[model samples]
Target chain A: MRNWCLGVLAAFAMLVGTIMPAAAQLHVDVTQGNVQPLPIAIPDFVAATAGDETPAVNIAAVVRADLGRSGLFRPLSRKSFIQKITNINVPPQFSNWQVIKAQALVTGEAAMQPDGRLRVDFRLWDVYGGSQMLGLQYFTTPENWRRVAHMISDAIYKRITGEEGYFNTRIVFISESGPPTHRIKRLAVMDEDGANPVFLTNGSYLVLTPRFNPTAQMIAYMSYISGKPRVYLFDLETGHQQMLGNFPNMTFAPRFSPDGNKVIMSLEKHGNSEIYVMDLRTRAVTQLTDNPSINTSPCYSPDGKQITFESDRGGSQQIYVMNADGSNQHRISFFSGRAGTPVWSPRGDLIAFTKIEPGSFRIAVMHPDGSGERVITDGWQDEDPTWAPNGQVLMFTRSYPNGRADEIWSVDVTGRNEQRVNTPGPASDPAWSPLIQ
Target chain B: MMKFSNAIKFAAILSVVALAGCAEKPKAVPAAPPAPPAAAAPAQVKTSSIVPGSAEDLRVNVGDTIHFAFNSSALNSTAKATLQRQAAWLQKYPAVTVQVQGNCDPRGTREYNLALGARRASAAKEYLVSLGVSPARVDTISYGKERPICAESNASCYAKDRRDVTVVTSGGATS
Candidate 1:
């Protein structure tokens, strides 16, 4: 018995040593290949049941599209696929993926549940290493299967990138129609890929600046609902809305706090506009700026300890930062022409803004201390920039001279990979939501 | 260019209909008027009245609007002269309440232009008040780039858009 005990102790010690080095073998520093996209493969998901064949195909398609658009992963086309996935329940044929030169492989199976739900199980494989990197299952309604796909894509993204996933997210923007001067603006919501567009408001009133909460479940926007422009808070789950404050004047440019416990907005008092905040729980209103100059477009830092805004007090519209309590105000932007609509990045590293020059409006970013100014876009008008959840991309409203809000475009912080964010109509004031819970 | 100002007129009319007693509600675009099909009458006829609310009434008589330098809210000589005439007209009509609407060329940032438009309107209203028009009789609203008189993005068109226009809400009792 004593000899057996000693042998067990030796085995346990050896096991700890083996596991430590094995776990360290995954030297996945996703940030190292910042300039190069990782090569990935997603063979069509296997359908356990005959009726779920379409969903299995669709799930793979969406996953491929999501990964492709991220600017991080390159999804290999099926035309180049060497293996047809028939059994996702078993390990993938890694040698076949290796021949196709795929570094990573994704396999999944979809089956209809007994009560009309869809059960999807997927695994992420490190093809070159011949190992399973991630495995997860989702059970959801058939109608919401797309959301399930997004969630699955998000899980794989997080596991590989070692970062948060913004795939399962949405954006709320003002969908615009009609001529430039007679624009018909409506509040609209859609998935981040511009799918499932839903208009939340009829063309009854002009709406602007739709902002999403931290959880992406609620939004706060400005609407001229009663001929008086005021801010509104909307719930995605219930679709109910309530006016935010009893401002006797026009209130616009609403934004949510990092925690979604407060809303910061601009209130036009008499002839001057100032920044104010409203607490969601206490219904308490606090004035954040009190100056003769207009202090509009207020945004909070990711930590919520500081606020960045634009003020014209210094002769021209320049960016300013103030403490959450409205004290310690100082200017951050000092560029030619003017700058407005300052938004802090979620990573709290940079502040994106609209840089107005002679006959040009550019989307640019600067450090929080007002250093390292770099304009990412060049157009006649590119204004009101909002950051993606990952803080790598920015979406802004772009239009030419005399052009009606033409298009919504996004550019990476590195200023490459500029592309239009697809929308139903000409759109503006886009606010990206955080990853869905 | 012509259709836009008419749309503004229609927006004003709809603003009155939608808000009812709140006639002072600034003419917010798309305020229950998705299709502004009926443009105003021909410019010649509409631009002929000395009576308040008439295009010519405000234009031919009080010099309806004033323009500013690019990205500036400070009044220029042309703007001050226009406001002086507006003040004199307001003094003659004791009951007239004018809403000084500040506008800007679509050249600036939306929020900054809104603030600058407010500054332009406020600058004009202050000049009028200083010239003896009652402060209570004037209210200011900034349209920013939301309402542009010219749809083109040239120097002349943008100049036309960046002006403060005084619109009469109610004609005062004539002396």
Candidate 2:
């Protein structure tokens, strides 16, 4: 057991080294609207040994897919490449890449070390400026090649977009199947690109709204265990599950504190739902909202100073904000339609939610002060907006008008490149994790 | 003696007519007889099929489900009448305990719909208790929009989805 735990820890802690300083010769301003995707070229990573060929080629393909999906980088096909990269230690042929209108290029090499670990080195280059923009190396077990690929993608994305990359992340969601009347929903986690999916529970009972803690590998979700619906916590490493609180009534819509020390959720008693907070260490609970109206879906700001939730206290469901101590509560949404499921961005600048229009529901985002509300997607039924760690993108669940299927979709904060994420089956209630360390 | 036998036959014919009338009614009438008394010799057969004080009796004889408006949990006259029958059925079967499940249409956010479903279930439970059912014998759960009986997105289907159903959990006979 001890050896197993140590192995898990080692897999999580990949050693990273910066070999060269990044230059700003080639940059993409992601904050601006209507920006063009920068053309990039990524050839296969050269393998130093015969046995390392598979990992080298697979890593490069994953990195290319990651950057291409971000919508800020358009990866040029290998068929269009003019020069074949044989050595990553040396700079690429800039004139060959320049003829293809490639603004940036990425090259890497993978080798098996004497200690039975994989050593991967990558460098991002500026084609026009003819210089190395960034260079980095990582050491990890050979089996964790996908994570290494994601980390390399993050480095290239950060060097170009001037923002943190979300490639090194995981998404936890409810994998749904069966028919509409008797659907089976199980809690499942996967890579951000929908790889290595593992089901945490069997589909005996229903589960919904699995949320990841910002600072830990723990998840808080609602489940109908033994016919009682309540909030429960699951440890990702140990696979141990426990009910969050022993409240006399139903507890659900749970979210973690920004620091991951407390859990805030709704407690229903005698048909009235109110917000409550519990310290995980002490298991002590405190009431946050005492209104008869629904005060659920509570989320804390990145600073842990304030909270945003959805409530019907003012007749229709709308988004509201309050202090951390439950004082000075006020509604922030005054639009014509109803709004709910408010999640504060990690950057603490915007809150993403679902807007109920006349005939449809759309995923939308607004500033903390209730200004600059923008509906990003126009699906027939789109809800449950979760933020990317950098707050530059949002993922949500979209249901078809036929009411037979539900799928997860992602869109940019600037309302561009709406695409459906691949899952094994019908899925919903997606929660994106922070960047893996 | 002949007049007494004729009176018995007349009463049996009247009850058969009443049962036929109830079958045509839109809602399930709690007071309707389970079978016609004209077939008195086969009374044991009818009782064996649908045992009194059973879960099937509560579902078929007395109404087991009631619906609410789009976003409101306040019970209407139709819903109240159904709960009254449910209370009578529970009182007759004192050993039975039930769980009221609240459901909603897929028109609202999940968390809010869950809270709304809880309200709808509580509304039914409260009415049953007010009509003399013991509070200890009734429990409540909210399914929100997770379980919808109707899959279409039309108003009629939505109305069917927004409902509360009482299910016998323990100590009830099964048929």
Candidate 3:
């Protein structure tokens, strides 16, 4: 009886031991983590078949560039890549990526199909877990191989940020070059990463403040085409254009009403700038302000009923508000600094403006009631603040003191993540469009 | 576009300056003895040009100035007197239309300036309307502080830009 009891006890002990080891392996107690940009090592995609040169290498460079510009990923350089990604089934040397502080490692292999297509098979591995999170493969034409790489980057960004990737988006702005006095402005569009820059409007005429319609295919801007400053619209897909209205005076600072169905602008008639809204479909005009003050730079609220514009009627340039139908006008900005160029965010969360304080000017954001004002950027001259599609960032133009040139820059809403975007020429008046789903 | 029309526009602009050049004190011209209201009817049919010295010239020139009361859109007694003189000129032409541009001193909100400028212009328009002058012969535009008479920044200068001028828009011929 005693021997039988001991035998049962021993079996129970063995079972507990087995379960204990499994539990220890499954449980992880990490509460805090590296919140910094994820360090990633991208191995060159091994090319199975040569294309043009002696041999075509992997598309790792394209992937690396895409990830680096995301402002969220730090890709390790190839010079430090410990091992080549030659096989799909081989496990990565996780220790090597760790030595280089790469929290994530991506490996891929390229093969040429008999049908004259290139197939890229890739994998993403979590360095800390020593496990694979994703394995994806894409087939594309050799000429479009870059797209395949961008798709890979999108997948990685989505998995990490839990947000849709903006890799394939396009940005349109006024391509400005030359001195401020002789500024040659043209409409330019390019990929969000400053690639494939295409000039939409030639620099023959003066163009200022190009804003993208919600569709990203239409642009409304102020142009001196008819020898008068007026608002004009251009269709990206149709390549057709039309003037906004036949107003007698110069119409400056034109922006699309929230719905893109109307344009809100300041019309300077008889040297008095007053806000006016024009219906796109009906060619109807509604005057929002009858007062004589220089009421320019009209921006509609998200709901389109109220418009905030800059006026010097009170002696100094300040912001004012009024109804869409031009009633119940009131003062909104009691701040000391001079505020001009108020732009309402798409989300209706904040209004961005350029405040000229003392001898300096800065870009700032404030709540609708003119409270909780905060300046986001400062320089010799930084104006024309436009928000990104997601409201997560803002882009504006900054010119040096000497007024040598201007460049477009972007900064995250937190005031961090400030970076200058590359452009072929001096770019200004950057208007971010809604995400082109 | 030859010569940019600069001379014609400049001369008309000069008269506007000249009208504004008067004084901070409001002055009134003699009323044209109530022209029986029928004479003012043909005055409404004419397309008066705002040339510097035309028969319909009503605009004050660039260097000209007008004054408003403290926070008041009502033309002061002095300003009313000036409008009287202005009214006599409008009656003498009989074929002229004029625009009264009203401005305000820089001590209030811009919306108020816009409203105030309108009120000041309307006040002048009302006086002209009261002077047996047909309202149809006059128009009003308020340029809050956008077109200041004085380019400098001081109380004296601010006071100067805070006034209005009458621009002739009908029968006029000036070199």
TM-score of each: 0.84, 0.90, 0.63
Better of 1 and 2 by DockQ: 2
Q: Could you give the candidate ranking by lDDT, starting with the highest?
A: 2, 1, 3
lDDT of each residue in A201-253, candidate 1, tens digit only = 99777777889999777889877676656789888767788888787777777
lDDT of 1 by residue, B1-175 (tens): 3455567678878887888875565765766747877688665544312345343566666688888988778888888888887887777667778888888988877777777787788888888989999888888877777778788879999888889988877764221
lDDT of each candidate versus the true structure: 0.80, 0.88, 0.68
Better of 1 and 3 by DockQ: 1
Model 3 lDDT tens row, A37-151: 5678887776666652211343677778877765567888778877766665676777877888888888777777788766677777777677676677766666555555656
Query: Which candidate, 1 or 2, has the higher lDDT?
Result: 2
User: What lDDT score is found at residue A343 in candidate 3?
Assistant: 80
**Model 1, runs deviating above 4 Å:** A1-34, B1-56, B171-175
Candidate 1: residue A163 lDDT (0-100): 73
Docking category of candidate 3: incorrect
Candidate 2 true-interface contact recovery: 0.89
Give the DockQ (2 decimals) of all models: 0.37, 0.63, 0.03
Q: Write the per-residue lDDT of candidate 2 for residues A1-437, one digit (tens) a residue.
A: 11212332354323234334445689888776336889999999999989889988999999999999999999999999999898887778899999999999998889999999888888888989888888877877887788889989998989888899999888999999998888899999988999988899999998999999974479999999757999999888788889987888889999999889999999999999999999999999888898988889999999999999999999999999999999989999997889999999999999999999889999999998999999999999999999999999889999987566899999999888788998879999999999877
Per residue, candidate 2 scores C-alpha lDDT tens digits across B1-175 of 3355456667878999999987854775588666755644643433234567778778777889999999999999999999999998898899999999999999998988999999999999999999999999999999999989988889999999999999999988753
> Which ranges in model 2 have alpha carbons more than 4 Å from their true place?
A1-23, B1-48
Q: Rank by DockQ, descending?
A: 2, 1, 3
How many residue-pair clashes does candidate 2 contain?
0
